[model samples]
Target: MRLLSREIKLCSVLVFLFLFSLKVLAQPPAHDPSKIMRDGDRYWTFKTELGIGAISASNNDFSDWQSEPSVFGDTWPSWINTYVPDFAGHFWAPACIFLNGKYYLYYSCSTMGSHVSAIGLATSPSLNNPDWTDQGMVVYSDGNNTATVSNAIDPAIFKDDDGKAWMTYGSWFGGISIVELDTLTGKTVGEKTTLVGGNHQDIEASFLLKHDDYYYLFVNRGLCCRGVESTYYIQVGRASSVTGPYDGWRTFLQTNGRYIGPGHIGYNEGRLTYHVYDRDDDGTAKMMNTTLDWSDGWPVAVEVTQDPPGELLPDGTYRIQSFDSTKIVGVANNSPYEGANVEILDFSDDNINGTSWVINNVNLHQYQIAPKNYINLGLDVYNCVGDDDANIGLWSYWGGQCQKWIFVDMGNKNYQIRSALSNKPIQVNGTFESGTNIVQMSNNSNDTTQLFTLVLLELEDTTYNQYPQVVSYSSQQSGNPASNIIDGNNSDGYRWSAENFPQYVVIDYGDTLSISGTKIWTYQNRAYQYTVEFDTDIDFSDPYIVDRRTNTSAGQPITDNFEPVAARYARLTVTGAYDYTGPWVSITEFEIIEEEIVGADELTLNDNTKIYPNPVVDVLNIQLPAELSSGADLAIYNMMGQLVFRKTGLKGNIELMNLSNLKKGIYSLIITNNKTFVTKRFVKY
Candidate 1:
């Protein structure tokens, strides 16, 4: 009975292998991951590890995962070492796709920081029981060979709507390039076409996706592999076809708080997969997933704001300096009283406390500026009047329109701080000496007194607001396009006007948002009857309308607040004019305001709880109130809202915690129990 014994042993080995793979792994560290593949009830994805490791998820749960077998195990392709001879046992940026009932996996093989690389291919029938057959190298790069000199790495395969296959591959040496491939053989059939160049030589990791009528190309740029200091971010461009002339390059994702860098994007099954370096956890790369929303025919990552390169002023603590480098904005004589005059003064150590200001983002392209020593008082225009030469003062926060400010980027880190109430830039009153009063004035193209510089003290956690963009409009006059309405400018030269009665503009904020109101600034001070409509779809089918017809007001800016509604696309239709009945309609700026919603789970401030040495180093001491003397739950989260430390069932009022292992960044300490919930911010060095 030898045959029967052998069969029993073989069956037992298969059963053990299946049971071992059932253990779920929490947060499997993956880098340069491929688009997830599916086999029956299991999902599979490959990543760059020891010769390309694979992971799987079962029962339709995409987050819970288990480590699977490596595609080649200890035996890699034999032809890899022949080309460059610096081949190692590791791979980089693997990509996979299914074609003709077979899976084609493409990967990169290269040395560190070099262009002598190659892109290889392998095929398998089933991922659940993989038997990958090496198909040799598809493309390579050489220093001496003129035929294949392009740095070939990060191979991403895409199947067009017409059922033709193509591969997009390259690295820093030649930016990103693409070539057509035969669907049957999974090999290149045409000459490679260079798609786009990188910013310097810091761009790589290209991924291509086809949605609707356009082909979107995603790439990574800036420094990488530097832990918390990595500047890697994602950029996107789109073209009508799969090949040349890809324009409209825009920043898609960026470093937000403890999430240092987000790159290497893959799309599958209505969701996107990428990796972000977690600064709270020693800058480890972790996998992240998000969905997409369309705004004006372009894809925007859901719930993520696009911080435009070189133009965005992130929320933080800064010192406001005028065009004169030695002078800065401060309270007159360092006064702590409300309604104190804000004046420009010379920089000195005694007046450093008055120069520190906290800039908080209130809306899209808007901020609420306040002194760091007194956050309750904010910069405001006196009397709330909308006119030129309005004096600016430090006043208590009353949620007035004059307290809200808009920062207009004038390039080179210089900004024109404009008032939201008057749409006028704040100037130094035509003087540069000490104690010069700051006032609001008319727009001037070449005024240095109006431009101010923001010197950052530290990078802090910032909230996000989805960027609203103008996508479509009914009609526009020459030299004044529809996009000027959302360019964060209210000047007369930057406006959209048309010689028609029924001209309209549509703005897309990417996803469905809780819209509360609209701030419309027209070209002239004329009364106009308009109707605002909103819809979740691009086409205004079954829209929520806010009709403002039969109105009689001639205000420059008409602020209309309505019932909160969920919408994605907002349309403003100018029906008729009341004061001047002419065939002309113009709009200078349009802003959709979001409604703020606070929940009961929010933290409540407690005066009894005191934290010592706010900019603490190594150790942190927390003195809890008498109400929290009993057992409580303590948690510390990074700026990206990621929990880095948690201790449950903590007792006593004075708690001494060691934080020597944490990185140098900002953190929020949260303490909660059955009867108490408190939160505080501290710095770690």
Candidate 2:
């Protein structure tokens, strides 16, 4: 029955165009992964073999990874051969913990499937510094009496809430076992006791996590190291005490479609990291990450899809209600065009058109908000300004900083919607009223005026380009050349830093292209003031100030956007750090964003609309169908669906619109009336 059920589940997954495969990305191969560790701004996870391979990611994003030099780097500690005479350089299932201002890394040493194994320890002052001091064998098994002893492999360390430390180590030989460890010396302190799988069940790689009142034990079951054929899955059990007769073990994670052999669970900050056989990639072992949803007492991994374009929110229809519960966000007079004032209004069951909004998730926790009345227009900060009390309004959705909002969850289904431009939440001008204006202001967490609740009404899917190519880059600092900013590594040793104030870095795309925004991965999480400028030519004769930020408290990878502009060069000038008083400026990585281009096939429109002079410079003529001529409205939006031009109450089939001041780019012309709606694509040169 179990085998039949597994086959049926696999068949169902194949019918959905392999939606489960969407969660997998091109990641470096990793096996027996260590618990993810954080060093300053980077995340590190060690793997088995290849000298204890160390892999890292920047800004806490595990989707993409970069490999650092291995810890041993071909030099093995001489003491390993003393235990297992034929011991190779390969170490397995490393567990790392930071304690007392130092890091202790424990690794398993032995040949494959051998009971004559030993666990060794290495200490380092810092992860960035490769000065690992080898501490000889912590524990070992002779295996001379094979049937009576447990194999010393896959060591996992757990520190209880009482500050007492314990080590759990073993494999399939005689079952999993646990022993107390001295936190000061990283060594065993008491005798070992067998826990589970007494010489019968195929179990290994055990890990323990304490949450609330339970100590949950996680272990791998079934065969491993067989590539695509491996059946390794994660099983978990829980107990009330640190050491106990645990409850019945149940499957926690198993193979899903192309993600086969999910094993070696490592957790950090409510997120789980493991390795899986990627059937799609020739069964290669790859690292996988997911957030843990503990709402149901037990932890369940939540599948995270690929990041949306920039910081757009997930595609959905929602009701945005203020914390007062009586008020919701609405457009003034139900207007559906640019510059329409957004305000808080009394909730009404029949006011769906005024209260409901369409939100598109881009990346991280940020989203682009559009009203249901006109999904083409987005919620905007007036004039793209980040000043306090900046009025919030409705504008064309152009993927600009003014339209993106970060939803900060404040518990109880309440959130603080902060503007990506100003890093402030929309608050009532003074007090809540029937038509109180909403303006961006500094956050006061306790203020009810700034909190909102989003009730999801519908769901949709959208994709975006996360990172565009950077052909070349230059910076003002020579000591740490700006070239490091585009080197594809965000580790501490590969950052661009300058001790001088007003330092700058320039990224050149090698060709003039439509760019919407850029994000900076700063050296550290300190507040920095900076200015961004864009230009088509290398010379600054006609530069456009895209964004100028000051007094910001945003964390690493600070993101900002501007209206889509045709430029080949972008410059970031660091004015100062930490209230503009610090002298040094550092940056690890700089990403340039390309404007999002939603294809015409993605839109539903009448097929009769026509436009001429696609690459128009001064004037654009539109030949609309007779049905849409009179009493109709026309709106011109950029590639990102941001409204650039609009007119109402049209009266004729032939409408001539002048776009002389518009920049060169692709745009969509949308014409609508009470009954007919159509959209046509054009270009402005």
Q: Highest lDDT: give the candidate number.
A: 1
For candidate 1, the C-alpha RMSD (Å) to the true structure equals: 22.4
Off by over 4 Å in 1: 1-27, 59-61, 144-149, 198-200, 304-685
Candidate 1's displacement at residue 246, Å, is: 0.6
Give one digit per residue, the lDDT tens place, for model 2 in 1-685: 0010011101000111122334433455567788888877778888886467787877444555677887787768888888988776777888998877778899888775567889999988888765898888999988665434667888888889888888887776577888888888999997887777643235688998888998888888655665455667788888897776676455688764446678888887545778776654555677776667775567777764421112223456888887885788898888888899999887676667878987765323456688875766789999877578989999755445467787777677577888755567788887778788999987788898888878878653222121122222222244455666766777656777776544555555433456788777777665777766676543322467644445376466777777777665666766566644555678787776877443332133345566777657788988877677789998775533335788999888888999998875555566766543565656566
Which residue segments of model 2 deviate by more than 4 Å?
1-26, 304-685
State the lDDT of candidate 1 residue by residue for 1-685, as single tens digits: 0000001100000100111012211345677778778876788878877668788887332556778888877668889988657877677788999999899999888776556778899999988988899999999887443223456778889998889888988765556789999888889997888787521133578889877889999888654555554556788889998995677666788765446668788888666777776644655666665567889878787754322212335567889999865789998888867789999988788877677888765433446677776765789999876568889899755334477687777878688887755567899987788998999987684998899998998556432222354544555676676767877888778888877655667776644566888887877876887878786544343468777776677676788888777676787877668887777788888888877543332323356777877677888999987666578888886543335788887778889889988875566677766643666767676
- Ten residues in sequence with the least summed lDDT for candidate 1: 1-10
- Each prediction's TM-score versus the true structure: 0.45, 0.42
Q: For candidate 2, which ten residues in a row score worst on lDDT?
A: 4-13
Clashes of 1: 0
| Candidate 2: residue 51 Cα off by (Å) | 1.5
Error (Å) of candidate 2 at residue 60 is 2.4
